[model samples]
Every structure is written in C-alpha cells, then in structure tokens.
Target: DAVYNILIDRWTKSSTPIHCIAHSLNPWYYSKEWINDVSGRVSPHKDMELSEERNKCLRRYFPDVKERRLVNQEFDRFSGGLDAFGSFDSLEDRWVLDPKAWWLVHGSSAPILQNLALKLLGQPCSSSCCERNWSTYSFIHSMRRNKISPKRAEDLVFLHTNLRLLSRNDADYKQRESKLWDIGGDAFDSFDNGAGVLEIASLSHDEPTMETMLFTDDED
Candidate 1:
C-alpha cells in the first residue's frame, strides 16, 4: 500500500492535462474489464480528475467557445459509444488496433476531436528520449571542447544524432562479424570504430595509459 501510494503520488506529480486528455481519448479506458483490472481506476467520464483535466486541455486547444462545445458534444458520443463509435467494427477494433490508428479509422465522425486525439496519443509520455539527445549534446559540447562555437556544437550534435539514428537501421549494426554494434559503455562514439579499438588506440596518445590508471590508487 505504501509503495502504491508513492507511485500514485509520483504519477500525479508527473502527469499533465495532456496525459489526462490522452487517457480520455483512448477506448481501452472505457472497457469494463480494463477498469476492473486496476483498482480505483475508472472511465474518463466517471473520473472527476480526468474529466476536469480533459476539459482544461480542451479549452486550451480549442479556445473558441462554440468549437469547444462541439468537441464536447462529440466527446459525449465517443464516451457513450454512440453513432459511428458504437459500430461493431469500431468496438471490436478498440482492442485490435493501436489507439492512434483506431482514431484514424473511425474518427471522421468527430474530426475536431480526432485530430486532437491523434496528436496527443502519438506523443511520448516521458522525457527519456529527449534526455538521451541532451546526453549526446553534453558529450559533443564538453568542457574540454568549450572553445567550439554554439552553432558549431549544435550542428555537430545534430549530425551525430542523425547518424546514430540512421546507422541503427544498417545490417552491419546487428552483425557480430561486423563488430560495429556497441553493447554498452560510457563512450557514445564506439559505433564508428569496430569494437572501439580505434578509440582505445587514440586515447593512448592523449590520456593516461589505461594500465597505469587501472593500477594507480589515490590516497585521500
């Protein structure tokens, strides 16, 4: 119970109105089995916090009062499973397809809400991916390389990030014989040198010898 309470508190702090809106738009939340599977969790319509946040998001996105009202009316139909949303195909497809794809299929009836749902549902729920990009930025713009101009640093980071992304799709990235893949390490540029042999070789000239560093101990 304590662990659950901590997790719930953390989630509440991290969650935004967009998260609530995404939850409200997802069809699985309306499922009886899904609701029952998670204690204290309810459909968006029945969840006061979720409904409030959903309304807040709606107002922010659809600032026009009349347009917001239209979206809300459409939301009612969606939540109630009325009209096109209630069709056997859509109801069955709720579990069969991804949320964004499901919206793409049956969302023509509520075009406004559909567009909002597609955008919100497609977003990443966390900043981990962005943090990774920042990690690469830090590596490129390190203290040792502080003399590099911001524009040059930005360009290098962009080039490095895109290259890493493109390289992942190459066949050699996964081939053991190619030795191009980086299983794990502190260094991020290992992919350029097979098994990082070239990196180790380069570091030997500029930095302390690996053997001496490993064997030496500091007395504090």
Candidate 2:
C-alpha cells in the first residue's frame, strides 16, 4: 500500500490519474492481477468505480438491447470462470504473448469482451503514430489535391496505410506477390528484387549508424 501510494503520488504529480489508469489498463505490460493489486491498495471502491466507468463508456457506444446483452454475457463468462479463457499457469509465457491474439483465441466464447479487450489493448500509449498519420494525410491532401472530396481523400489514406501495413505481414506479402506474378512475370520479378533489397537494407544494421546518431542529436 505504501509503495502504491508513493507511485500514485509520483504519477499524479507528473501526469493525470486518468492517464495513469489508462496506461495500467494496457494488458501487454500489466495484467488483471496488477490492476487488482493497485486498485485494492489505492481505494476500497476503486475497482468498482473503474468497472462502472468502463460499463458507462461501453453503454455510450452501444445502448441497444442486443449489444447490452452481449456485454452482459461477456461479463458472465469472465466471472463464471477465469479458466474459460485458458490456463494461466504460465504467467511469463502469457505476458510475452500478444494480448490481442490471446484474447481472440481464448475469449471466443465472450465475443464482446474479446473485441473490447482487443480495442483497448491495441491502443498505443503515445500519440506519435496519430501525429505521423496526420502528416501522411497532409502529404496526400496537399494544395494540388485540395479539390479532392473528403470521402475520396479518406479512402485514399485508408488504402495507402492499410496496403503498407499488409505488405509488412509475410503472409499478405506472399499472397500479393503470387497475385502479381499471375498478372505479369516481369513485374513480379521486379517487385521481388525490390522487396529483397529493402529486406536486406532493413537487416543490415544491429547497431546505430552515424545517421541515427545525428537524428538522435537533432531530436534531443
């Protein structure tokens, strides 16, 4: 309790309590056990309050009977048996595994909670990616492209980002390559060579280069 208070005091002084709680909700770094411990020590009603807040948040998004029932069903599954998810005997292994993937596989019985967990756990702790995405949007919807409709611009950005993400995944890349090959042999060969070069370049350095050092200095 003393340690918890100390940490909470430090965090509160440096940042908002809500931000700290949100950060703690991230399952990749902290699990339910951690939440229970912190909340238990922080305040007797902390857990209940947090649960109520989460319920309210969900309700705001989904107020219909069907969605509410789904949420209730998910809660029932969770409360009925932790074993419903899987054996938590290997805590270290579970921690190392992606929380999103784990929830998808194990929480299939609780679809609503599975979806909720994925959404929460997948949230980045920082806004850097969002800022970069805005930069992408600006580049895509530049002065010359100002005439583009909002819907068209949105579609273009979505396709550009998602395609780049898909290309990073090996299975998706292979599938895309196969489709490209069917379209044209020369094009496929050119794509394969370019991809190979990029892969080699990405793997070329384990240590920081002079350029990286300069970038770090600039950031500092």
Candidate 3:
C-alpha cells in the first residue's frame, strides 16, 4: 500500500518533495541485514538488487565512485538528512512531527524531501545562493583532463549538490517534474499477451506499488 498510496492517491499533493532522495537508493538500507535490523522477517522485495541500483544511481550522479562516495558520505556525516527519503519507512519516526507528517504527506515525497533537506543544509542556506558556487567548483575540478584529489573532488560535488543542486537556476527542475507526470503512459495503451511483453518485464522487476512495500517497518 505504500507505493499504491504514493503513486496513486497521495501524488495529488500541492508540493512534491523530490529534493535529494538519493540515499533511499542506498543498497545497505535494502540489504537483508538492514531489513533484519528493521524487522525480523526477510523480504524478497528489496533484496540484493538494491546494491546494483545504488551503484547505478551513484554512477549517474558522479564520475567516480571513490570521488562520489567521499563527498556523498561526507555530506551525510555532517547531516543525516539526505538519506532520509530512501527508507523503508513512510516517514521519519519523530513524535510530533512524524505523526503530523504521516497524517498529511506521509509516504508521498517525504523520503525524497528528507534526502534533499539534509543535502541542502549548510552553514548558511537560501535556495538561490548555493548552486552557483557549487557548479563553478565542479567545473574547475572536472577540467577536461585531470583527476581531482579525492578530498577535493568530494568538496566540489558536495558543494554542487548542496549549494547549487544540478537544477539550480535552470527550469530543468520543472522540466524533470513535468517529465515524470507521464511515466506510465509513455508507450502503449496497455500490456498484452505478446512476446515483447515478456522481454520488457524481464528487463525490469515488478512495478512497485503500495502493496509492493506494504509491510510495516516492524513487519519487514
């Protein structure tokens, strides 16, 4: 019901919290160990495949793992917010705030926002200010043919992701928001008994829905 509520009924919210939900993709959170940590029963749902997805998302996010991991890990260290969205929980576990949030947005974009909130925080913050400096730094560090020291590389990506998120000043943010609106309707009218159907389904796992991840954190 988590995915059902999210992709269906709850998607009607006024503000979508797609901030830095990158951490939700963290393989560790979906690992058998983490599942066991959060609940006693093992789930076939998020199993080992999460590691592959984590690596893929990270690769799209940064040029190098050592470089990417350094900055991402560091950013999270100073703040554990960004990793918030990618959780098995519909929302955080705070008393007052969590209850209210669960009552409202709940599983909606809660995790995504949590991730972005953490990534966005800094000594000083304003949506407009962070990205410019960050991009310049990334551009400089990622010069045509030079490898940045891991520390320096991290500093650069951290600044970029934090200060000037990839969509800073650009409408790419809105553009992306617009794109996701039609994810399900992109191709044909519906799935049918065709050979290609089998091939496509093989290409990806079952589409996630509320039922897909419905077990409580304790039930997992």
Candidate 4:
C-alpha cells in the first residue's frame, strides 16, 4: 500500500471520480508471512525439500521486475521455482505485482496489505465486481487438473470472471456495481448486473442475493 500511495501520488491525476477510484483485491504480506510466530520470516528451510539449489536465479529472467531482493528456498518449486525468490514478506511487493499467477491468487501476501493498496490503486475493496453470473460460467476445471482447449478455456474463464467468479449473488452485485459506476459510470454499470438485463435488485441481509429478470429469446 505504501508503494500504491507513492505511485498514485505521482502517476494518477484525475480527481473527478472516474480515474480517482482504486481497485485492488488480493492478499497482503504481513499477515501471510507471519505464520507460527515467524513474524514475517520466510518459511523455515527444512533442508529436506532442497531438491537441489537448481532454481537459484529465476528472478534474473524476469523482464520488467528489477533485482529487488532474494527469495525463499524451501517453498514449492513448480514453475522453475519462480516463487522460491520473491519477497512477498514485504508490503511493497503486494501493492505492485506483475502478471504472475500465484502472487495474485495465492502466494504469501495478505488481505490487509492488498486492501490498503487497492485504495491507492484507485480500484476497490472487492473481488466480486470482477465477475458476472454463475450458471452461464460453465468450465471443466477441477482441483485435480486444469486441462482444456485454450480458446474454450478462455471463453469459459471470460464467462466465469465477468459472469460468475466475480459475483454470483445480490449484495455483492450491488457493492461491485456501485464501484463500477464510480470508475466508469453508466458504461460499466450497464455491462455487469449478475444478470444480462438492467433492473431493480434486492436481497436478504445475510446472503448475496438479488432479483433480476432472466431472458430467453427462443421463447418468442
């Protein structure tokens, strides 16, 4: 978040509402890194998982990311040990991460850190507004595996993200909808309603529910 504030202080200029809003929704650093009294220390290197020092310089290959710092050696080493070197232990890394899978989704970064940065990134404190509906978001992914055609997978995820994964119910829809309006006004507001059509919505306080009309042109 500190980095977000620093960057926003210099890069972002608009204050008329649209460009002024931030939208960051991910884990933080201190929280995840502070496990079992470790207090932000890297996971203990058991020396048992040191398959080998084979992945020592994966970061050197990172294109835009500079040689910021060293990495942990004991963590999982799937993608050529990409994570074995990052310092998700720091708040700065959470605020401005690149296009890597684990960092945004998993990694050690905490929610508080990313939440703070989301404020500075001018985005929102949400991951809900990120998607659309549920039923239409059909994909064949499983924790057991994720193998599918790139094209169909893209469409499924696209549907999943814009229609389902982001917000599948009501209260979330409203909250995210408001944030969208803050960023892009009616344009974005009309695009995502958890339902295809725009209309009045309501839900119970406990659940993320909303009532909207579903359509089927074939019925005509």
Q: Quick one: best lDDT, which candidate?
A: 1
Residue ranges of candidate 1 with Cα displaced over 4 Å: 1-5, 38-41, 125-128, 149-151, 163-220
In order, candidate lDDTs are 0.76, 0.54, 0.40, 0.35
Q: Candidate 1 residues 182-217, lDDT tens each? A: 322444343355434443443444444532442242
Clashing pairs in 2: none
* Candidate 2 residue-wise lDDT, 81-189, digit = tens: 3455345732433456676666665667777667766776767555545755786699799999899988988898898778765654445433544532221234434
Candidate 1 lDDT trough over 10 residues, lowest sum: 211-220
TM-score of 1: 0.68
Ranking by TM-score: 1, 2, 3, 4
Model 4: residues >4 Å from true position, as ranges? 1-43, 46-48, 51-153, 164-220
| Local error of candidate 3 at residue 185 (angstroms) | 27
lDDT of 3 by residue, 140-215 (tens): 6766736768777777667655643333345553345442122222432333553224323422333344123222
Candidate 4 TM-score versus the reference: 0.20
In terms of TM-score, which candidate is stronger, 1 or 4? 1
Report the Cα lDDT for candidate 1: 0.76
Q: How much is 24 displaced in model 4, in angstroms?
A: 27
By summed lDDT, the worst window of 10 consecutive residues in model 2 runs over 198-207
Local accuracy of candidate 4 as per-residue lDDT tens digits, 63-126? 2343212222222331122342344433344434531332444444333323333344443334
Q: Stretches of candidate 3 above 4 Å error?
A: 1-46, 71-220
